[model samples]
Target: MSFTDSSKKSDPANPKDGSSSESEKPSNEKQPTKTRGQNKKLDRSSKPKTPLPQKMDEEDLGICIQITEKLSNSVYAFGFRSPPDPTDEDGQSYLSATESPMDFQTLLNKLNTEGYRTVNEWKNDMNLIFDNAFNYFAPKTMRYDSAIKLKDKFTDLCQMFTKSEEERWMIKIEKLCNKYISADNEQ
Candidate 1:
């Protein structure tokens, strides 16, 4: 199995052309001291080093906790933003912050249950004022675009329903609410 054994078995008629001896003669080339196995073992010993978790300061942690509490108690549940995105930043602030968010279907269901006709009948308690009102019917980017009151927005909505037959208080309210639903107010 050794190099010498192979050389002896070769036909002498055709010489290896000193290729066999070339490996025997050490050249100026630097050789690796360790075998591949040894190198791999060393690599394994080194381990995959990873950065440690950065420690948070107690004060900073406490401050974050405080902010979370304030946001939870803030009453203004923004239609667009969750807790990760706070109220102050987006101005989705509603007077009835504690109210749950309401979509068109939920509003309809509420109307059915409450026997209400117009937003005026229920007041602007739909949580659709300021950010809530503006954000209704608005795309994500245009959500906070219009900062109008619930009543004004309702008026604008009235223009859309030009027909007098649809001028019923409930119908007008439905049209507006369907287009621009904000959040739901608690009982």
Candidate 2:
């Protein structure tokens, strides 16, 4: 799947039109001086609470697609590939048992739609697919065994991909930190 532009956009909250909001303007009233720690807290609090979606690069996206494809193609994947049909008896029972039901097909849809912001988000949803299965079925049951096998397979397949993603994340973080440090020094 093709990724959308990943470039950072200006935050509307901090406008670039040269007009500052009343809250942003320096007040005439003398303000209490904040300590370095307090300044850091304030800076953090001023930023958005939720992280914006970071589009996956081609290599990462390809790896994710490969993993999902493998899981979907597996014989054990039949039951876990789609959500249970609510009209059927077994489906009704599955729906009732699973609080946060996840399936491989849904994961694929999300990937296509760019619903995931990061690799971790994709991984968490994948884990949920297995976790829901594990929770719904008894330990010795065939379905449970299948879920365990699939989960193990997922873990094995993701090792190298995740390690590389982690390295990329660290590098991005370091660059951001350096940019902030330089900006602070200039100010």
Candidate 3:
């Protein structure tokens, strides 16, 4: 035999059925109310305020240290090279390098043997300069200046390499050095 479902039928003692038993009385109506203890309100205004310290992780700290070191070296090199020479009213320094009588052809030939096809190409590649100067006792500032001057002359010669090209390459390199130093100081 199939059992009839009783889910739809309401109990006689339930309030919804409009009938009640003593056991089915509402506890809120029958029970006495309890008084709240102490009634103490919190003084939120009296709480102490403190600032949180900024958090930097180990990896970030390491990166910051490395960047700082690179920048410090760059700054030291710049100082060594151009040591705060007096500037004219036009803002140009008197410390400019004049043309030397020495033959730079031997040096250019040496550079060519090391895979630099042109002086302009050599100046364009920072990685090449870095590789060449990595173990040299030569001043970095001088090397950087030569690279910049070469680029300037190259632009004038080609007429194809615009101001934007100089901006994209030479100016960007200088800015990167400055940024690296700045980031290093922040750490």
Local accuracy by lDDT, each model:
0.40, 0.83, 0.41
- Quick one: best lDDT, which candidate? 2
lDDT of 2 by residue, 11-122 (tens): 5476574555656765699889997687654456777787665786655677898999899899989889988899999998888777777899999998888888777788
- Give the runs in model 1 whose Cα sits over 4 Å from its true position: 1-100, 117-119, 126-141, 146-153, 159-187
lDDT of 3 by residue, 58-137 (tens): 33233333432333244333422222234552112212321111113323333435443333443334233333333222
Give the CA lDDT, 0 to 100, for residue 171 in model 3: 61
- TM-score, per-candidate, Cα-based: 0.23, 0.61, 0.16
Clashing pairs counted in every model? 4, 0, 1
Ranked candidates (TM-score, high to low): 2, 1, 3
Report how far off residue 148 is in candidate 3 (Å): 1.3
Scanning candidate 3 in windows of ten residues, the lowest lDDT window is 94-103
True-structure lDDT of candidate 1: 0.40
Q: What is the lDDT of candidate 3?
A: 0.41
